[model samples]
Target: MRIDASVITPYPTFAYSVLDRYIDGDIIIDKSSALIGTSSGIYAVMGDETNDDFAPMLMHEFKRREMLNQRFTLFSSSERWDRRINELLGAKLQRMPRYSFTFNEHRFMQSQRAGIPDGFRLNRTNKESLEVNREFDAAYIRKYWGSVERFADKGFGFFVTEHDVFAGECVSIFSSEQYAEIDIVTNPLFRGKGVAQCVAEAFILECLERQITPRWDCGLHNTASIRLAQKLHFAAPETYSLYVRK
Candidate 1:
């Protein structure tokens, strides 16, 4: 039985609940309230034993979508869901381990008054900057935040500039009332100069002001990101796994 509804009704799953904030349109919720699909090519099942019963039917529906060779991750928590989804997809799933770090507000505030690097100024991404800013990569704006207009209107980000040239940026990948996940990228020329942290510091401080916690998650193998989180005082890592089709 297909449940024809857009905008996933409120649930406790961190994955789906936070999704509504990032996405601008409808989130399809199928029967059983377990399978949630997005127009952005992402299909996720709520991570719980109760939702396990819907796995087979959900896979069938996904196949019926005839998405061709388009790739998307199956996000879940149960190993049982993983196995069943693998069987339905007819492929060995690629297991990717990830770690999530909790925010340390007090530590973040330590650099509240910190100064920007020499010759560089810090600024928030606003409609004016987004419209006229040529220093930032246009592709990156689309890939991470969907578009410059969205980021300017609904999202929060900080960019560092040296003489009006982009140095680095830290932006909210997505946010809910409880937490906001951060994504950071630095221009290659300014990578080793601690530019990423400067902008990230600004982002976290703003999150604190708004009473929203900042979240950091990265692949287990991403040592650079892990270290950066540590330097920013985000510790106590928790492990989670996601299923990817090979």
Candidate 2:
């Protein structure tokens, strides 16, 4: 059964991206007892834990779909949901801490500018770039946004290039009416040259121009990601537990 997205609380922006039809996903509701919003192997679970029938049904569905073998992740909405998932999945679940950061416009404006390195060019992502950029991988956009055409139409990003080679890119992995979640990748050869910051700054500027809030999220152990977010003036880290299949 399809459930109202409004009833699901404390959801990640990706879930809303699915619910709002900005991206393709599944909304699985168990007779109004529980709901699961899923897209691109990421799942958000919420609703009545006291319902005895829901957990077993969810477990069965997971096994039937071979979700564990496919490397799926589940986000818990509360401590109760955490306990419920633990009870159902047991040793199959590996708990990990994830961090989210809120953007600070003032700090971002005050931060030192990210200058493109000599001989490199920063450009907005377009259909042609999406087709030609191999280092950044068009597969990622397809995986998250369902197609290059959709992303090129509704999403935006910035990529760095040197002599026509892809150096780095920062893109909206998920976007809704009001939010754009950032994802970045830099060619290992170009790392430590501020390539990431350059593209990220461009992406953020585009988001701001559109009045959409930019979001940053990463695993707790991803020090590099945390550092970049902080450098970009994304403040106030809120930590949460992310559950993945073992």
Candidate 3:
């Protein structure tokens, strides 16, 4: 489900959050001010450009305070349900498009077939593990790869270090809903190695030992991430759609 660009003027913050989950969308525009977030950059209407940003600008006008009570759903499989729910916006639920890749939890420790080059080890992102996350921000993350803080308040990871440079990291985000969100990121120089798959295996084992079900998400166009997930064990592909007031 995608919200048209013109409707974000009044509530840009909410709109920015929406884009992190949207595919083929960027630059939410409006007037009043510019508010950019991690997933996509936000732009506000100004000077002669006012007419160009009408899409997001108008979205704000149509949003109702009652919408605060409305809920947007992310289905396990996207199936154009969001369009069907548009008529019920103020009265019932809001549907959005989202595709989830489900993977089985690894219970037993596999062999060391996956290697992390040499002289590096997996570490957690918690207070005790390491702090590579502080040095890395969202902007740098958007290029070629993206990663989550993984339960930020209580993050855990294996920091692959090369002579102490903090090369890359891995994590498994845990939510109360019992969903397994696998997250991994490597230093740009270490792209083609089996680093991610290695960390993912360990992460899945961690989730299984805790009894959590793993889940995966990627843009419909991000073939690399999608393939990696499938290779690492995302059972199959399931699609969901999203919709918002135009």
TM-score of each: 0.77, 0.88, 0.52
Error of 2 at 178 (Å): 1.8
Strongest candidate by TM-score: 2
Sum up the clashes in candidate 1.
Answer: 1
Query: lDDT tens digits, residues 111-214, model 1?
Result: 44445787789998776665545444445556545677765655678899988888887767665665667888788898878788888888887888888778
Q: Per-residue lDDT of 179-221 in model 2, one digit per residue for the tens?
A: 8998898999899999999999998889989998899999999
lDDT scores in order: 0.65, 0.81, 0.45
Question: In angstroms, how far off is 203's CA in candidate 2?
Answer: 1.1
In order of TM-score, best first, we have 2, 1, 3
Give the per-residue lDDT of model 3 (tens digit) for 9-99: 2222223233444212234344533322222222222222223344343244224312553322222111222332343342443434444
| Clash count list over all predictions | 1, 0, 27
Angstrom error at residue 185, model 2: 1.1
Candidate 3 structure, TM-score to reference: 0.52
Number of the predicted model whose lDDT against the real structure is largest:
2
Better of 1 and 2 by TM-score: 2
